[model samples]
Target: MEKTRAILVDITKCIGCQSCEQACKQVHGFPMETEARLSPTALTVIEEHGDKFVRRMCMHCEDPACASACLVGALRKTATGPVTYDGAKCIGCRYCVVACPFSVPRYEWSKLAPLVKKCDMCAARQSAGQLPACVEACPTGASIVGWRDEILEEAERRILGDAKYVKHIYGSQEAGGTSVFFLSDVAFEKLGFAAAPQQPMPVLTANALGDVPTVVMVGGAVLSGIYWITQRRVAVADEERRER
Candidate 1:
């Protein structure tokens, strides 16, 4: 089996160069923009958090809520540890957008027919045994990619070895663990990180979805009963008119 890939982001090492952002745009054939945000064209962004630079992108959860929210299976967590989207399969309902805890997915609002967009962790590059474009483009070694287990261990080592680290590994357990991990000197909440539930969202989504069949069956029965009663009333009214 292919080992799950992951990325470790050391916020302390980042210089806010925006190299990763530029690289992502270039690789995806998106037009260059002066300001980068988590938009349809820009899959990632580097936010200036006072003296620190925070990189924001898809978390790629182990059990992604976006994938679960996709009724048509347009979004899926691949075996290689990236959450990928199939534009053809997408119905443009935007359920994934609402379901994502990280609020990472973007839509091409300007396009006639738009599709949801987010980082796929450069799955094509990884399949060819190359690092992700952003990780490779990083001038500083802020963005590092490796196997998930190894990366987690490396994040631990950095925190343990350095007194500057904040001691919390963001994404390690948030939203049921993500493929991307972060080591920050400042509190993640101060960096605009959302407070996410520890439990995997897929569990909740699945439980809700499991109730769909029952709900549909009960609804159908009630609607049928109402229709039958209405038809009987109409028939009785017609018979009374004929007798009169």
Candidate 2:
């Protein structure tokens, strides 16, 4: 039995109260900081736009480009469907930083041995039959954690039932179906979300790298043959000079 996790974010329901951000910090045992500055330890945060507030956190993509870009497998999509990172395996290369489609992963720029961090969907709490701290803290039910498919279906249902919804599910198909999906009353662009490509981010790169093993083996053999022929030709030329 495979476990799949997801977060359903109804941006329309959010009141920008900042309780979810606080709950995330408390549940994760992260240190507190002043409201404006974001630290690597802060996995979730509230962003203000005019009179509205938006919450930002990792989307936990089904096929995370961060996991694909990681050369040493530092980032991985767990069986439970959360994209988790193992700090010990990270070399701080920052490839994952560039590869993330949602721009979810954040780096600690000030530290000597900086680490990349993001939300893990709170696997421990889910295991304990509890909801994620962010979900629990949301006063308006803005963020809810559940099955990925169900979340997507529900978001679609809402849009179909109400013409007021913008008719876009932010993470539904972006980066190959993110574990998290967002529903908004206003256009997502107005809320500061960039338009995402339809294809999975890794698919473009993986198509090229998929041939790497075969290309390397074939290339090595051809180069070896060329070297052998060059050496043999030099030996023959030397022999002819000696005969003359």
Candidate 3:
């Protein structure tokens, strides 16, 4: 019954305008960076491909590996669906950096006490019942924040209605269905979307980790059984020798 925090980015609608990126930096109160800061303060950035713009941002995965990898619990997802961070709890270990599939989280490597930073989906603004700065600033409504399920259905509807669309939703299946989704007219790879596998990136690693305890427990039990059987056999052999 509640609106889950989600962001929908339609590459087909983006016009290579940097307004969305600028709005994100401005709203977050982040330090002003040059156009080069495109990769840092700007949580989302648009890339020109032929004639269209491909915007990039954190996918905000339903099962975020970044959250899983954070030993200090700095990275977390709220019921509202925004993946948020707590700087006070962060030890600046950079586990989230390694775990992020989209490479969205950036560390302040230049600072003496470097901290990680990424999009919070303008959570404070959302709390005030407003849209994210990027979404509000998007001149063409290319980016809008809403519920994840509703947005996915809308993306599906667009693909079904438009024959020109690529028929592939970028974030729907990548990394286990992210809150952010994309519809593109051209190939997603051409737009610089990472070549994500059909399966979620974290799934493979998670499965491996899940099996570890099982494997160790089973292995230990089997070895113990074998040791007991061997000891029994040795005892029997010693008794046979004593009888002879």
Candidate 4:
């Protein structure tokens, strides 16, 4: 019932200006330069696909795999949308990086105390009732953010109204729906978007990790028993040597 935010991205409207990329970097106080990939410094990236340009960022899934994979609850899927991260709660497990379907989360590999980095759809800015930096900085109306349902309606409207638009809404059912949606004149696969499963990843992740705790408990008990036996043997040998 709580209205979650979504960003509707029209790839056809993008002009390869890189304005959105610049805005993301500036807002995050990075180098102010666009990178080829999503790094700790760059939350969003603009990739040139021949004459078309596509933007890539966190999909902000309805049920995010990154949040589920986090051992310390470092990542969270907020009700208003945005997969937010808390560095303090993070335990440097890097499980989130592995669990992400879109390959969105990045680890700060160079730093001694590294952070898992990715976009949160500008959670702070949205909380202040402002548009995301990338959306606000778009010279063209390529990207717009609003309620998830409303954005889906708009995406449908455009696809239905225009013959040039693709029939598929990229993020609508991908990984059980994401806050970020895409409208492209070209096929998403051609634009380098991976076809994600319709099932939410958290389900699969939870099932996989569910057995881990049991395994660890059993393994620890076995190791403890071995240690106790080894220590007892050493103590018995010492007594024998003293008696002799």
Per-residue alpha-carbon lDDT of model 2 for 167-196, expressed as tens digits?
888888677778888888887888887577
For 36-145, candidate 3 gives per-residue lDDT tens digits of 33355667777677898877777788778888888888888777888898999999889888878777898888889877888888788889889888899999988877
Candidate 3 — what's its lDDT? Answer: 0.81
Best by lDDT: 1
Candidate 2 residue 103 Cα shift, in angstroms, is 2.0
List the pairs of residues colliding in candidate 3.
none
Model number with the top TM-score: 2
- Against the reference, the lDDT scores of all candidates come to 0.93, 0.83, 0.81, 0.92
TM-scores for candidates 1 onward, in order: 0.86, 0.90, 0.83, 0.85
1 or 4, greater by lDDT: 1
Clashing pairs in 1: none
Better of 2 and 4 by TM-score: 2
Count of clashes, each model: 0, 0, 0, 0
Could you list the CA RMSD of all candidates, in the order they appear? 4.1, 2.1, 3.1, 5.8
Q: What tens digits encode model 1's per-residue C-alpha lDDT throughout 1-244?
A: 6789999999999999999999999999988884546999889999887998999999999999999889999999999899999999999999999999999999989999999999999998899988899999999899999999999999999999999999899998899999999999999999999999998999985788789999999999999999999999999999999999
Reference-based lDDT, residue 35, model 3: 53
Query: TM-score of predicted model 2?
Result: 0.90
The true-versus-predicted C-alpha distance at residue 194 of model 1, in Å, is 0.8
lDDT of model 1 at residue 154?
95
